[model samples]
Target: MPNALIIGASRGLGHEFVRQLAGQGWKVFATARNDAALEELRGVGAHACKLDVARPESLAGLGWQLDGESFDLAIYVAGVFGPREGAKSAPTRQDFDLVMHTNVLGAMQALLLVAPMVEAAKGKLVFISSDMASIADASSSYGWIYRSSKAALNMAVRSAASDYPGATFAVLSPGWVRTDMGGENAPLEASESVAGMLDVIAGLKPEESGAYRNYAGKTMPW
Candidate 1:
């Protein structure tokens, strides 16, 4: 069976990625900060791991543990909703650093660590991006920290694409799904968003790398 690794598998859309991928028969390396919340993922057929994407030291161990390991698909899904203190501002230095550390830095580290494996396996690397990254759709600057981080992530995906000529790289926006991060009032369900995302990712190719798209597979203006 193919192997899949999903970061942030504790809850929300990340949890759904673990469920859906495992259901599809992939050997999923599912990670989350909380062990209790992660049990269901292992029960549903995944290898449970605790990964804190925010801490550089925490992530370093994985590099040593999985050195040279190849995964059919690597999905980087760990992220926070910027800092709660400044949801509207440019984000305080602390929150900005936290958001950038977890979302952008963590993603870049993961992609870089796994690049050789992905290149060797001719595999896929997907970054869970957001429609908020769309410069054309920026009606509100509510999530300034989160939005800017995702935009950076989109660019990182492009950089990764350029680094690997044969591997598939994708930047996908999973839509406003109902979850802890998306809140109880969001427009989409976890299943709906994840399934749609899986459909788009299922058909990803090298030519499609660095493209900004929604779960429906429509290109979002960047």
Candidate 2:
């Protein structure tokens, strides 16, 4: 069975990834912040670990827990959508810190540890990004902070891809899915979004490493 690791498997898209991957007979190792979520993951046959991506100290034990394990896929899905304010309104320091730390710094830290395992197995490393991060397609300033963070994340992943030649790195946009962050008015469902993304992932070629694409497999502008 192929081994996969999902960071931030507590709820929303992250949790859905765990369910779908496990249901497909993948040996999934998932990380969540609380016991309840961890138990839920375990109930679905996933190996669950306690993790809060915002807290660096919490991620310290991950290396030891998965030592000697090689993952066929590793995904960093932990992120926070901060204030919905536009450019006219600046985000507070607390909001900036919370958003950037969870969405950007946390992924960077996790990549330092998880990328090696994916590389060891010559697997794929995916980061769940947003189309709002596209600089060329920017039509709105809404959620500017979130957009900026994701853009930074894209750069981080793109830059790091060269260092991990054994692994394929992809920055994917899940589109406007109806999740806790996307709200009920969103156009797509989590299941549909995840399924589309999985198909895209399955078809990714080694030469396409560091490419940015949507869940539907369309190449997206950076």
Candidate 3:
């Protein structure tokens, strides 16, 4: 069985990823900010790690903890929300700080930290990016923070892909899934989104690196 690491595994797509991967016989290393929320995965073939990905010290701790373990797949779902109603004009520094830090920097931090393990095993790194990042599909301008941060993530994934020739690095837009983050009106369910993505990942060949795509394995324009 392959070992998989999923960050931000407490809820939303992250939680579902852990569940589905576990059911498929993977030994999962699950990370969530709340150690308690991760408790739900107990006895579910997951080992929990608490991490606030944006914090250097916390991520350093995670690195230390994983010193000897190697994983075949690493998925990142840790991110933050954009401007919500009244929090605009006078947006607290914390809000702005969190939006960029979590969505952009935290993801890079997590990927960088685990790159060695993924590289050693010739594993895959799947980023839960958004379709909002595609400038090619930008017919409407919306969701500033989330969109821009995901755009940045696509670039970073491209760069990382170039740097690691032997590993699989993919940026996938999970589609409009019905999660707390995706809202009630989103078209896809959590299970649908993750299952489709897993199928895509399963079929990825080394020849197809540095591509920006969606959950269903369709090529997406960057």
- CA lDDT, every model vs. true structure: 0.82, 0.95, 0.84
Give the worst 10-residue stretch by lDDT in candidate 3.
Answer: 84-93
- Rank the models by lDDT, top first: 2, 3, 1
Model 1, 1-222: lDDT tens per residue?
A: 888888888888888898888888888887777778668777888888777887777677777656666888888888887654334445578888988988899999878777776777788888899998887898877778888889899988877798787678888999898988888899899999999988888888777877778999998898
Q: Point out where model 3 deviates above 4 Å.
A: 84-93
lDDT of model 1 at residue 77? 87
Model 3: pairs clashing at backbone N, Cα or C within 3 Å? none
TM-score of each: 0.93, 0.99, 0.93
Report the Cα RMSD per candidate.
1.8, 0.6, 2.1
Q: Cα miss at 70, model 3 (Å)?
A: 1.6
Best-matching candidate per TM-score: 2
lDDT of 2 by residue, 1-222 (tens): 999999998999999999999999999999999899999999999999999988888888888788899999999999999999999997999999999999999999999999989999999999999999999999999999999999999999999999999999999999999999999999999999999999999999889999999999999988
lDDT of 3 by residue, 1-222 (tens): 899999888889998999999999998999877757768866566898878888889999999878888778889888877775331445566766788899888888887888788888888888889888897887654566667778898998888887877678888889999999889999999999999999998888777876778998899999
> Total clashes, candidate 3?
0
Worst 10 residues of 1 by lDDT: 82-91
Better of 2 and 3 by TM-score: 2
